[model samples]
Target chain A: MVSKLKTSLAALGLSTALATSMVSGAFAAAHETPLTGDLVIFSDMSNPAPRAVMEGMVARFKEMNPDLNIELTIIDREAYKTQIRNFLTANSPDVANWYAGNRMAPYVDAGLFEDISDVWEGDMSENLASTKGALTIDGKQYGVPYTYYQWGVYYRKDIYDQYGLSEPEDWETLKSNCQTLLDNGVKCFTIGTKFLWTAAGWFDYLNMRTNGFDYHMKLTAGEIPWTDEGVKKTFANWRELIDMGAYIDNHTAYSWQEALPFMLNGEAAAYLMGNFAVAPMREGGLTDDQLDYYQFPTITPDTPKGEDAPTDTFHIPSSAKNKENAKAFLKFVTSAENQTLINAGDALGQLPVNAQSSVDDDKFLKEGFDVLSNKAPGGIAQFFDRDAPAEMAKVAMEGFQEFMVRPDNIDRILDRLENARERIYK
Target chain B: MTQATLPDTHADRGKRSFWRRNQIAISPWLFLAPGVIFFLIYVIFPVFQSFQISTLRWDGLGDPEYIGLENYRELWDDPAFYVSLKNNVLWLLLYLLAIPAGLFIALFLNQTVTGIRLYKSLFFFPFVISQVVVGLVFTWFYDPTFGLLNVMLGWFGLGPINVLGDPTYVTYGIIAAGLWPQTAYCMILYLTGLNGVNPEQIEAGRLDNARGWRMLWHIIIPQLKPATFIAFVVTIIGALRSFDLISVMTNGGPFGESRVLSFYMFEVALSEYGFRMGYGAAIAVVLFLIMLIFIAYFLWSMYRETRGR
Candidate 1:
């Protein structure tokens, strides 16, 4: 009697499983287009402005799709960097915030990130043309970039006006400007290399200007050796700036934010920084008119100017439980309207990547859009750390920081970087 | 005492007798089981697992590839590894200075006086605040442009010393910052030890005219051996685990000059650099081995003491 009961119980369990699958299949077939499921997103939108924008977007998405349950988890940026790999493997979220270019390559290579080519083949193909190159690996698109901003020399207009200086257009003029600033008791630049990546802004611009964008990309991609003459020339030009006392004396002690005081006080003339610096500079008591943006002065005049444009993106992890809802969420978030919302949001003063998105009315944003669209050659290269393999980037940034601190050690630093590149890229 | 005073039935007496007969043999293992289980799970298992992981090329996500000793081979030529090892030695040697410094402070505050407790707690202020906060405070203090250290140095026409920037000075600067709290910790340990010193023995020493250095060296120090031993062990462990202050102050910067083994392992495993779990685990294994030497000696000495007792 017990054996007969057990057999009946097994049959009941199998039928229940079959019935649930059939019911879900019927439900899926009924609404083949509209998404209805739990959509979980993990983001490192810790910065207040971006966080607000993301929250707004999520609320709007919920309103649009009443059937979908959206769960948003905002983690601290630094913690997210480590936790992402773990979560992507174990308890993967449907959508996650990450960077584009080489920063996304490792996850893509490990098959941890989903290939969102179908989503890209839809509206994104036309809307996000420029950023597609950054998110593509092995001919498959993996992420959708939402925002990026331009990096250039942010200068004190008041200081430049007082010194009777023009924005340097080429290497020679830049040196002359440095000389004039130095003579007038102003340092040519102020940078905080304490975080290391700030120095990469200088390296990226110099390398791009000296050897052109292709060479810079090749070097960052580990195709060219650091000991190459093109690499050496970049350092040679950087050395001249060091010899001229162009930067703040003890830059290594300050982070990029900490170095802003020198420029605000007119002790230093310019800072090679991204557009995000403008908000902080304004908050530090500089007026809109007092601060002006200029492209990094031309180094090798004829080289295609490659500007640093670090793009932020979102992707679906391969292990996501709600793939359909994740695609819908990605589509909604990257819409031109939502992109414009993010642009106008108070926290993030960055430009949207969408072609049809409304531009921010801010002066710096206008200047950044103009520079990035008109001046940059073959579009923009992601900043150094974002463009290079992470291990190589870490060593390269350290090498740049060391060179800044002690220019005399350039050859040794280059050799050390080459060693790191071999180990990392291998 | 209450249990013994209570009346017992014959069956209860029999049960008590049985427990009394077997308790010596079974009780020790019962008491030790929880601690041993914890040690096996948290400490011992991880050490062996790290060794296993060091032999494989895992990225902490996918299947680990067995790569033999390739990670170690790579570490053999890794300049950063040597730099970290040298810094570790420097940290270990300089970190020992805390024990003496702590003992000095303890001696200074050992006397009875009004409001002495308040003063003692105030002296221990550095230990109370988290190390991360102390690190930030020191970073500001060492800031080249507007730091208090630079301002004071300017008064003497001396320094705009880029303490964190100069590789020659960065490690020392961080060690000094670490020493601030470490010294306070040692001071507390010594103070507790000082309190437990036999007053009658001190009275005997006083009657015999053994005072000051002689009293401290002969009569006092021998009694404080247990505290010294503890202080030595903790300081060594603290020195080996010196990651937070280095991470906060310099981040092994000015060309990776200030990296310690722990920070280097973290950089390899979890930083913006893609995770090289195998390589990082190899580094961890080496650090564990180095630490194991000290641990083995400690356990051996502890065993001898227990055996003698």
Candidate 2:
């Protein structure tokens, strides 16, 4: 009788376990089975708007195609360059962000990036044309540029008002403003070169305003010498500003984000940075009416002007598990409506690549559009460190810092940069 | 009588041969498999690949051009190479100070008292946190304007000295940060050793009027030799492999002033600054060789001690 009871208890336990497993399976089936394959996208932008827009698109894509899944990883900008290279070797992301210039050359050569020339020819010609060959290397398009922002001097209008100064249009006027601010016990400029990339903005703006677009391309492509006289003159101009006590101390110890307090407290008069500084300005309690943008002051009268507007681009990796799904998502991302949603968001202060799209009516963006549309003749992207190899850039920025602290060492600085260029390029 | 003798001899021979065959088959494998597999996977295979690649000029991607010895030749002229080597030596020399300082602390806290156990644990706390956190803490502490050290100096009307910004003091500042956790680690090792030291010996020394420095040098230190040796070995390796502190604090900066060999190797191979993988491997090989010299000395000492035992 005891053995029969034990047998019945065992049967009951087995049935209960079977029922639980079956129930879980039924529930899983009932849940919307989105895409089942894998897609990985790597990006450097960590702001909420871009993430929201991209996540929404991923969900939509997953719902439309129930055999695919997507994972998006955001790397901090400083570490992305090194970390991305490591990722490419073993398990490359299906799609990833890469720079558009000679920076992509190394990866493209290694077959790390997929050759999407066919994608451009068939589906993305408009996207290709709008980016102006920025994502093309060796007559082949490897990536699609999704966002870009103009770089320039962002200044406090209240300080300009207190000093009876208007936004300077040329080098002479800019120098005069700096002197005036110095005389009035206000720091003329604020910069944080702690990570060293922020210094590139100033250099790019100065170079673009001095040399034309062709020279900028030549510099980026490693065709021009680092010790060129035009470059030297830019350094000399920067030195003059530094000598006049134009910049804040301990700049080396602070990131650009950390310098917000200086501007919020009215300790520093201006910041030379990308349009993305608008978010920080708002975060620091500065209303749009308080902050304003001006073209970086002209350095040469006849120089071809260029906008130092850095851009972000997406590339399909060669190692993607599901290339078709990734390409489909890429198509979805570049669709006109999606581009509009992305541009209207807070993550990127980018104007729409699609000319016909309606941008969100923000005053700051309207002002940005006005500046971009009416930009100086022969406007091109800024070409300081981005134009140079990363190795040369590291040495060159350090040289800039040294020159800032000790203006007399300009000759040594130029020589060292030239030496670095030679060593790095070879 | 001859048949009986032959059968006995054959039985004895068969038994002896069976045992011998089994021993031969098993003993060789038992000695070889663990060490050979481990060496192949962890050390030998990787070293061979690194050596093969050091002859090829590859940017870590694409087809590598077999340019033999070119990377090593380039290393001869690389100034940053020398700077990193010098910084590494400095790291080693200064890092050794943690050993004696740790021993000093262990002696001080060896006495029994209320809350003494908590005191020992509190002293060991820095070692528990990661090197990355320690680097950040020190970076903030060495900030010229806002750092604790500078603020204290300002109270005395002395310094707003740029500890990290100036290339001169940058490496020293990083070394000071590294020492914080490293000293804590050594202190714990010594504390454990002190707890196990013969109390009867201490009492006997006290009877002989041997106390303080004389007692420590002649009696205590000799007894703690194994702990001292282990402490020295770990500190040496930690100092030589000092990468995280440099990376987190300065990124080998103020114009690459604080770069040790390991960070320099990484920057050369994979950083945005460059991707000379061959050159980086060459640097690694050089570092490995330097480390091997010390490792050989350690092994030889261990061998002699064991053999004597």
Candidate 3:
């Protein structure tokens, strides 16, 4: 109750700061701070809409502070992941886009990111308070959240209706529904484990559901042994589904995009994916009535439904040339107005960071927002890959893919992951 | 003035003539310096650096900590490392098939019926296509659903086999794709070699009542040794560096079953999911050692032949 009151008070304080700053033109950059020189930004907003949004942000920021030269270099999203380490140490950008969880651990531990706790003070802290926890490491905030989206079972609603089935609320019901779909010549799920991270989604939900959120966190953070009883239980649950032949065959051959045709063509009835899948699914010709979502069903029944909502964020590199300009840009990005603009339906189509910013009216956005905000009681995870260290995540996800293909190999896979965890976390 | 100056210049030339004195030996050294320098910097230095890095634990960022033999220790225990080594050996053995297959194709195409030029070019088409494109084409060809291979198998009612997906067949499937272009490359080399064949020897063989296999083996093959040597050398190198097809087709997966040392190195070091520079360098060191053995053998054999001549 006390924490809730503090949050509201922070939000109120933020509202006033945003208003006064906007009206007085102080946010043209930062208050009483004139910006000069180059404000270089390295963004992984390579996808068309996100790229446009990045460009728009730069243009708007430039318009406001004409003295500032903002050089925005947008890189291919996947390529940016590996390149960030190089540039952060060598050719540091003023600002960069990264994820908001333990994905930031390597950078934070290496002291690559600047301590941006001052940016989070007063008005900014309240507005962007929700994701402050995600960007924090060892009691210090390192970055600010720009966007996030939910991961869930995106299913074919029409196929469910055709098979006289409804969204399963439990494991048994889910299996039964899958059995029905299988008996009627449809695979229960269409997954492409070729890149391996797709399989991690299943692990994230299965482990979280079987054990609960805190246990899942411990496992990812390498505190819990991968060969633990809880981990085995999670794999056992996954095995039942695999044994039922519930997934599309040759899934290891397809990427998530390639796997979409199975769901789109109705050979498979559902896909366990992020909100990003909705765009491609819609583009592939599924109607709103045809496509629907459900939170991953409860496995332990009362494990307090934790959710995966991977958040993409912005950070200032500690070695940046333009620190003052970078800080101002970070504040400007998280301002209620900019969050609303960039995360609009026509732009990122994702959840805004600012509590004061309104969410888009799109059905997926609304439901994802509701599930992330109200329905999820356990906690929000930054997905498996983002939550775990990069090396462990890669090894574990490959193990997940192997288990999916050969469920009997669970013992070997777990042992391998346990070995990796010991080496990686140490 | 001209006569006096000429005598003085002649005296100066006596000292400057040190270059002229050593010109025969010095010219080649001077000419070779740039190539030698580039080879040392680009090739030799990096090779040594990889060895140095293999003794450390680096994430390609921050200070790389010296942990002598640690990365190699990890590699020794790594299952993925063993899988890659075994796959590389398998690739080396099967990829050699391209040589005999290329010879057969070259012999078949070494004819002059009408429009044989068009047929020869057609036979040479696979080598002309980029490996990336060939990789893509084969990926689609071997795709599980709606693939031409599966469709044809459907006629035989045999299979809808996912060649690239199944761990059992994945390496073989990729090797087969590699063989297509490699066979073409060898065929082109053999054809060029066949053009330089001594017709006098063929006549001598015919006069000795030698024909077909005997005549070709004794007469033709003996003269094609250089081409055969080149073909064998290239094929081994190609087999060892089998990355592009694996990358484009399966990405060394279906549980990373198709990974060779090079692809595995890229995966652990440079790929989006990977950043273990130390481990990658260790793998690279192993690959380098493997290549070095083959290279040493090639050099020894070449020197022996040259010395014999």
Cα lDDT, model 3, residue A130:
65
Q: Tell me the tens digit of each residue's lDDT in model 1 across B1-309.
A: 457436544435555676665767989999999999999999999999999999998877767899999999999988889999999999999999999999999999999999999999998999999989999999999988878999999999996899998899999999999999999999999999999999999999999999999999999999999999999999998999899999989888877899999999999987867488999999999999899899999999899989999
Clashes of each: 1, 5, 1
Task: Locate the minimum summed-lDDT window of 10 residues in model 1 chain B.
Answer: B4-13
- The numbered model that scores best in TM-score is 3
Q: DockQ winner among the candidates?
A: 3
Docking quality tier of model 2:
acceptable
Worst lDDT window (10 residues) for model 2 chain B? B12-21
**Tell me, what's the RMSD of every candidate?**
10.3, 11.0, 5.6
| Cα-based lDDT at residue B122, candidate 2 | 92
**What TM-score results for chain B in every one of the models?**
0.89, 0.90, 0.93
Q: Show pairs that collide, candidate 3.
A: B253-B256
lDDT of each: 0.86, 0.76, 0.89
Give one digit per residue, the lDDT tens place, for model 3 in A171-273.
9999999999999999999999998999999999999999999999999989999999999999999999999999999998899999999999999999999
